[model samples]
Target chain A: MDDQDQQLVFINWLEDHSASVMKVARAYTLNSEDCQDLAQEILLQAWRSVPKFSGKSTAATWFYRVALNTAMNWKRKDKPRRESQQPLIDINVPEPHGPDSSERLLHQEMIENLYQAIHQLPKTDAALVLLYLDELSYQEMAEVLGVTENSIGVKLNRAKKKLATILNGGCDES
Target chain B: MNLDEYRQAWKEDEAQMNITFDSDLLSKEVLRSHQSFQSMIYWRDFREVGVSLVMIPLWLLLGSMMSLPWTWYLTIPALIWIAAFIFVDRSRHPQRPSHPGEPLLFYAKESLEQTEHQIWLLRNIFWWYLLPFCISIMAFFVNVAWNSSDGLLGFSLLSGIGAIFLYVIYSAVYRLNQTAVTEQLEPRRDDLQRLIDSLERETDDENAGDIMELVAAISESESGCGACSGWLNWAENWNRLVPSWQTATAIILPTLAGALCGWYSGTQLQIPEMGPTLFQVIVGAVIPFEIVFFSICWSSSKKQKKIQVARDEEAASKPEDRIKTTSSDNGIRLPKAPALVILVLVIFLGVMAFVAIGAFFLHMKEDLNAHNAQVIKRSFHCTNRV
Candidate 1:
């Protein structure tokens, strides 16, 4: 494809599937800064990968594969540097506003707990949980992860169990 | 809440976190980043091949100027061989497949293949990169020493020293490339392999029912009152003082020591003035050092200023807005460099400027002396003819 056409397709895909990028970035990284970094990296990779879109797979599948692969590599590369330094402060959760503020706050807390639990799982399992949480079907997840549908089911069940353990463990401690 | 409710919340949060981008801006940013990345690889390839290409012209120029024997020119073909070898090898390996749209397993495997190829090139660098150049350089040195007034002893000594020096440099290059492969590339390759294995390996389905039951039980038993410990921010605190003096000393002392060592060696060897003088050598060395040092300091200061600005903005804004501001900044910034670093930089620049001025005057003086000698020789010839 020509550069303009390729770019047009990429921007549309990015707009359509940006949520997946954000979720993958959030699931893989520990902080907003790293999330931003990983998100930009995924975007760049996606932009580069646009010309290779063959219409064989859906754009969502292609973008997820790009983001997940980029996140996995990024996490591995950034591990040592992240481990060396201690964070000075925690990221502040945005205050819930308007009607049903308390309900929004509770949901926010659950989501935060969900992310923390996700962080504790193995990288691949974390990816599976993120895909599952995003409501990707077993077949879609299989295509993104390059595994059999049956394999996705088995691995994802195991990952979900591990995730539940972490979340419940956090709740009991609290 | 059940898994279905959690999915609902996830989708809700994803909606609330709706990030819109200006396609033009994003495209420009991506293009800029892609160009920078491509240029870095291009620069590295140029450095590797450009050196050999440059040596061909240099060899011819020196050969013509010195009136060396025809055999000395043979090294040109050897130099070409080295450059062509690198070019061909790089072309053969190519870059990682550009299509990241492939399955994760396939993409990871392609990446692993690229890393393994890099390791192979570095591991066998002696054959393609070093050996041909070594042979050409030795040949040139042997030809020069053979044609010199000093006889057999001088030839043997020159050839022996040349071989040893080349060996040291080539071996060091070999060792460094191997070290990089071991310390960096090999580990990355292994990581990719493991990732591929995990993706390709299927899990047993027998335990799927048990795991699903466990997940359901855990979800049903949850109270949903887990404390929302905030995510850790990645910003590093830059309030501590940097030991600028120690850093300056560490950089400056070794450079001065190396210059002194070079001077001492020159004096001890009573080296012939076939090329640059000590002053010239020092100037040549210091210019590159100053350029590199200044670039590093400039980049560091710029980075510090950016971080300081971001921090100031974050501090002034509401807590809820801080994440938005920082995330939009798109890069990690630290506080400005300590005053001591600036002070050291000024002093360093001042010293280098003084050295540079002195070298310029010395060069002018040499030119004036040569001009005077030519004038006197012409006058003597005129007087003799009269």
Candidate 2:
């Protein structure tokens, strides 16, 4: 309604979803420096586009869409980044007992594997997995993608199978 | 170990992170963009808006003073003010110089390139082409009020011929001066072009799609795409005629017609019986026509010759250079001896008036109108020597 009120809401929304933005940037460029630049560019575009935003889709969904589109279409004029080769972080595996310390370290390792697995999925499918993992409703994900809610479920299922196959070292197909 | 656990961890990680944005550098660059765009949009055009504001009051004062029913002497201030404003405005707002650091040779080349469009706008309109024509019209009305017996015939002929003469001289002089200016302006035009190009390149990287689309649109209107060689040829020869005595003589035809009318009027006042003579009719109609004919003929001849020469030269030159440099920078060459032609024409007109008076005296004597002949002779004697 007012400038300050609008700005506060936008900053709160942007800060809450910055990890999603960083994940999209990481997909395009695994190198930390390049990832930071890509993230900054996405933020700049989002800031410039803020005045045009109308209250239809939730801010988080809109932010997710903008970040995803930037990463997918990001054609760097300089050298393109190489595909990331780092091992995937394993987020789902529970630790076999050691101490609470060992359990926390295992949990961190699992979260790191999950992020690496999301980065490895083909760019579009990786975005679907990230949003699906965040528990975005199929309708909200569809609104962000400008597609039907049914398509979102189909894409999310496909993305999950793809991620699962990447995480499992091809031991299991979907 | 479950999908729900992974989803919760991801949302928590996103919520905990911070992103910072700094746009100061970008804002500064956009501010410094193109100079021509800067000047045209913000500075030079801004002054034009100022000029328009100043002009409103100036014109209003001028209109009130000129239209006010004061004695003829009171209008002199308004006339002087208008004349002064014209001179000041011309000098103060001389055309902006071309880019800086461009060679003098290139300046001259660009001058010639821009001559036609510049001259056409300046000569035909900007430099007040209509002012003299409008003045001549006003003069016709004045002449009518002063002497109704001669009818509108003499005044119309005089003004018509005079207007054509002024048009030729104005056009010629403007073109000639244009040549000189182009020679002086080479460095500036080059600098301006370079600045524009650099700005374009900067914007190109930042806005690739928008810049590419704009450049494509501009390329469509480019001068290089057609065989405009002939037009340049015409411009060059028309330029040559500017300084010639022939142009000056042509421009003075109206004054000559006016002088002839004065002489006829002086003599007719003496010999009333010879007022409607056949020679007078021929002189009145044919002389004005001849004056207009000579001015048009001279202007055309020079234009055609220039075109022919330019065509040959342009055909030999590289197509790319011809496109970039043609028609934009030709400085108008000022004519030498402008005053001499004007002075000579004025004197010649005076002499023609005496000739008309003498003819009236002769007609009266030959027709055996002795009283009228003596009166015509006395009037001619009293008038200063032709």
Among the numbered candidates, top lDDT falls to 1
Give candidate 2's error at residue B85 in angstroms: 43
**Candidate 1 has which clashing residue pairs, if any?**
none
Local accuracy of candidate 1 as per-residue lDDT tens digits, A1-174: 998898788767766677777778777766566665566667777887887788888777888888876776563223323332222222233468989899999998788778777877877788788888877888988898788887887788777777777877523211
Error of 1 at B139 (Å): 2.4
Against the hidden reference, what TM-scores do the models get?
Answer: 0.67, 0.32
Q: Give the candidate number with the greatest DockQ.
A: 1
Model 1: DockQ score: 0.25
What C-alpha lDDT, on a 0 to 100 scale, does residue A168 get in candidate 1? Answer: 74
Listed per model in order, the count of residue pairs whose N, CA or C atoms clash below 3 Å is 0, 43
Cα deviation in Å at residue B62, candidate 1? 2.8
Model 1: per-residue lDDT, tens digit, B1-386? 45667778998887776566566666665665565545545765787788889878877865665455676688788888888887887788665344556666676666777777878888888887788778877886676556542468978987888789888998999999999989977777766766666666686443222210001111101111011101112123221223355545654655565556556655665454322246544654465556545655666668777976776466334222213323122344333455345455547655655454444334434554576788899999999999
Off by over 4 Å in 2: A1-6, A77-101, A170-174, B15-386
lDDT measured at residue B217 in model 2 versus the true structure, 0 to 100: 12
* Candidate 1 wrongly placed segments (more than 4 Å): A1-16, A75-95, A170-174, B1-5, B68-74, B148-154, B204-323, B327-386
lDDT of candidate 2 over A1-174, digit per residue (tens): 465555565566665665666666665554444454455555544544465567576776767766655454343312111111111111122334566667666555666768667656655566677678777888777665555565555556666766776676653332
